[model samples]
Target: MANPEQRPIGDVSVPLNTGDVRGFKKEMGRLLEDPLGGAERLDQFLGLNIYTWVELPSILGILFTMEERDMIRHSGMRVWDRDSQGPDQGDQKWPMQDPGWNNQNERHRQNMSDLQWMIIRGIREAVPKGQNLGKAVSEHQGKDEALEDWLE
Candidate 1:
């Protein structure tokens, strides 16, 4: 059996309903407006000693909620806005007019990868040069896909 602690990226796609998406979007908007507070909350979530803040560019604003953050803490999945390609278009979801979405599974995968990278990048920016922050972020990124294999 595959070790429960180790999961592949393909296995970590989360099944988010419309409501989950909406709530996440709302919180992201609020967080964008207040980077410091968001950083504090994220630091809490990440259990990091450093107080790092990010000024979410107006073009980039999608983020997973604290609740969902906990839900997928080690699940290797995340919520993201795939339509705008940046984060401006939360209104366009899967099976909508967005190009190439085509199906629900595809949509979930898009957001999962996008959000995961966003989280990784956010941490990379916050960590100082000598702290081996990349290694730190990779630890979480390297966690075995504890979530169910969604590739099937």
Candidate 2:
């Protein structure tokens, strides 16, 4: 069996090595490009983390909610308007109104949305029937703590 500490990247499971950041990046890029196959790999990845690190599901859920709020805030603003009376005195466009900045923000929002959907899909597929990622992890932790208490 593979070591519990090793994380799967693509077809192989390996221990995380900060020195091989470039290699990890390359694999992630490849995974992102192939959605169908990537989903399966992502499921495995999330499953491993869900079981191995009890806090991960809650952390990811919080981060995902934060990203959704940020996206909503960005989308709610009218990005094409000028704030002429502001600090630039009409010499410079408002940062949010700048074409480049708006485009970049839109791209970032889209990327984050895609990533969030991918993670949600992966979790739905990876988790067993009648249980979500968060519930499963919480239940697992509860069982462990209960067992410990009983033992003590």
| RMSD (CA, Å), each prediction | 20.5, 20.0
Q: Please, what are the lDDT tens digits per residue for candidate 2 over residues 1-152?
A: 88967954332223433344334334433322343444454344444422212222233333234544333223322221221222322112212232332212544333333333434444333323443445445554444477777444
Q: What C-alpha lDDT do the candidate models reach, one value each?
A: 0.37, 0.35
| Candidate 1 segments exceeding 4 Å error | 1-12, 29-32, 39-117, 120-152
- Candidate 1 has a TM-score of 0.23
lDDT of 1 at 141: 31
> Would you estimate the TM-scores of all the predictions?
0.23, 0.21
What would you estimate as the lDDT of candidate 1? 0.37
